[model samples]
Structure formats: C-alpha cells, structure tokens
Target: MDIIVEGIKQAFILLFTLDREVLGITWLSLKISGSATFLSMFIGVSVGTAVALNQFPGRRFVVSLINTGMGLPPVVVGLFVTIFLWRNGPFGFLEMLYTPTAIVIAQTVIATPIVMGISLAAIQSLPANLRLQILALGATRLQMVWILVKEARLPLLAAVMAGFGGVISEVGASMMVGGNIKGYSRVLTTATVMETGKGNFAIAMALSIILLLLAFTVNVVLTQIQQRDRPR
Candidate 1:
C-alpha cells in the first residue's frame, strides 16, 4: 500500500539523514535495552547456573518460578516497578520513577527470567557425566563451573540474543516507567506508539522498520559468532 511505501521511504530518509530526534531515540533505546540485557546476562547466567548445578530443597519450585517469570506480562512488571518507585512506597527514597533508570530496572526484570530460563535449559542439556569427568581430572569446583559454562557458550549466546530481543522489542514497561518524555526517556518503541496514536502511521511504520533493522543487525553479529564457534 501507499502507506507502507511512504513509511519505508521515511525510514530510509531518517537513517540517511541521521535525524537528531530519531538518532537520539534509537541510541536511548539501545542504551536502555543493552544495559538491561547486560545486567540480565550476569544475574540470569549466575542464578541459572547455580540452580542447575545444585540440588537444594525446593529446587523444582524455584525453577517453576523462573519459568513462570519468563512469560510474565510486561504491563504487570511496569505496574509493580512503578508502585515500588512511587513516593511513600518501599525504596521510594531513590526517586527513580519515570526515568530511564526505571526503564532499565523494569526491562531487566522482564529480560532476566527469559535469559535465566534459557540458560537453565542450556546447562541442563549438557552431558550429565561431564561434571564428573572434569572433577575426575582434578578440576576445582570453580574451574569446573567455568569449564561447563564455556562448553555451553553457544546456547548461552542464544540466551543473549533472546534476552536482547525480548527487552528491545518490549514497549509496555518502557512506556510506563520511561514516561516517553522527548529527548529524555523516549525510545523507539514508545515513540512509535505515540506516533501511531497520533495517526502518524508513516512515521510509526518508519520507526518500526528501524527497530527491526536494529535488532536484525545485532542478531546477525551474534549469529556469526555462534556459527563460527560451532563444533565441526
């Protein structure tokens, strides 16, 4: 349709000209999502590995919780985060509501379970005897964990992609926590939503295209690394 064509053209123009607003939103989007994904990687990988390798009481319950968390609704996450950050709420003294940092927190909550769940599955998929093999070779517990993690690097990278994909594409939590203030917390997803609400379909489409392109570029790089590391 004419709208799709026009939107594509607008997207091209925005990228080619590096429109300040567009560029700023794009960069902020990356920053917030990237930060969230990175933080999630650390927390998710650690917790997942710990849970996978240990046999604690109520382990299944914990795993069930993590699995449930992976599918949590973004709006629910945003609402809780907002409430916690609101004045007179717990930890309200930090005053992070409606800020980019708040967005990061909400996004981290959204992405953490995704990454953790995938990581749990990845580590669990490893050879059961592998841990014993390493220990038989006199590897320390710490070194054994590190080696296991390295062996599972491929799927762990996939977790990164999934986590980044989840957070970057999510709009609800970002809108609620970010407030979408121009040049401040406005991101690609929120900007697109605002434009769409205002009937600027072309602009909204353009932003959507840009977001897809961005996600694609990052995934391409990750995919290349993943393929390169594949076992012959």
Candidate 2:
C-alpha cells in the first residue's frame, strides 16, 4: 500500500513536470489509436450501412463473417499482419514491420469489426416505420442511408468510443507490430508493461494513469451523447 501511494505521488509529479518521455509516449499512443479509430469508423460505417440497408446474395454470410471478426483476437491479428509484412511475404517490399504504421494497421484491423458489429445492431434497432417512410418518400438509396445514419448517430459515436478504447489499451498488437521501440513506437500500455518488467513503477504508473484517464473520458462522452440522443 505504501508503495502504491508513493507511486501515485511520483506519477503526479511526473505529470506536472511534463516529462518528455511520458509526453512522447502519450502523443504516439494518441496518434496511432486516433488514426486506427478513424479508419475503423470509415470502413465500419460503410459496411454496416450496406449490410443493414441492402439485400443481396451472400448477405447473411458476409454479416456472419463480420460478427466473427468482432471476436477476433488481437494477438491473431498481430501475427497475421506480421507474417504478411515480413521479408518473405507478398507485401514485404513495403518493409512496414516494427513501425508505428504497422501498429496502426493491426489496431485498425482489430477495431473495424467491433465498429461494424455495434453499428449494425444500432441501425437494425431503428424503427421500421422510419425506414419504410423514407422509401415511401422515394428517397434514393444513398439518401436513405444518410437518414438512417443520422438517426443512429449516438450509437455510432458509442461504436467509435469502443473502438478507440480497445486500440488505445491493447498491447498485444502494438508490441508485436511496433516492436514497442523506445522513443518511437512505444505506447502507454506497452510502455507500462516494459517499465514494470524493469521494476520501474514510476513511469508505468504515470502511463497507466494517462491511459485510464483517456478511457474514462471517452466513456463519459459516450454516455453524454447517449443521454442527449435519448427519446424525449
């Protein structure tokens, strides 16, 4: 308990002092996770809208695949991306392994399925009458999709928050793909692990504090959005 209290004290001091290494790791974490979340939103929203609104051959199969992807293990994603980007793999020419970009790719892959699954559920939960009314008004397919997305905005934001939370806290993919290199690809979670392994609790505590704050802030914002969008 004394050690824990001392660690918190040191963490607060480090935070107030604006330690360069701490700030750098925080910045890199935000950059990679933010980019991953953006990419996930782009792909997930499009794919979710298509699955929710359109009917075509193999639609069920596609959605089932997405549902499966929602449960994909981060380590599996990391391994798959590592192999594909390794020297002997097809895209090995790009030589992207052990970099921030590789971490982003892995994180994005892990996040997209989550966003897709949640968005699909949100869209499907909308009132059927709203969809039928839009069709009756002769709204184009694109316009109808826009309407549904607008109605589902709150849930979509929740999906984005969830994806951001996952990627920001995940260490498996980041460590494997980014190699968790100091002063470069190291992020809060992976850094915390590395620091702890070296018996350095101060930096680890600081990083953990920052990561907790980020997750808490995102969840609070998501809750507010949900309340604002709730039916009056």
Q: List TM-score per model, in order.
A: 0.96, 0.93
Residues 88-123 of candidate 2 have per-residue lDDT tens digits of 998899999999999999999999999998999889
- Model 1 lDDT per residue over 1-232, tens place: 8887887788788778878888899999999999999999999999999999999899999999999999989999999999899888997999998899999999999999999999999999999999999999999999999999999999999998999999999999999988999999999999999999998887787789889999999999999998895666
Largest TM-score belongs to which candidate?
A: 1
Over 4 Å off, model 2: 221-232
Which sections of candidate 1 miss by over 4 Å? none
After the best TM-score superposition of candidate 1, give how far the Cα of residue 194 lies from its true spot, in angstroms. 0.3
- Using lDDT as the measure, which candidate wins? 1
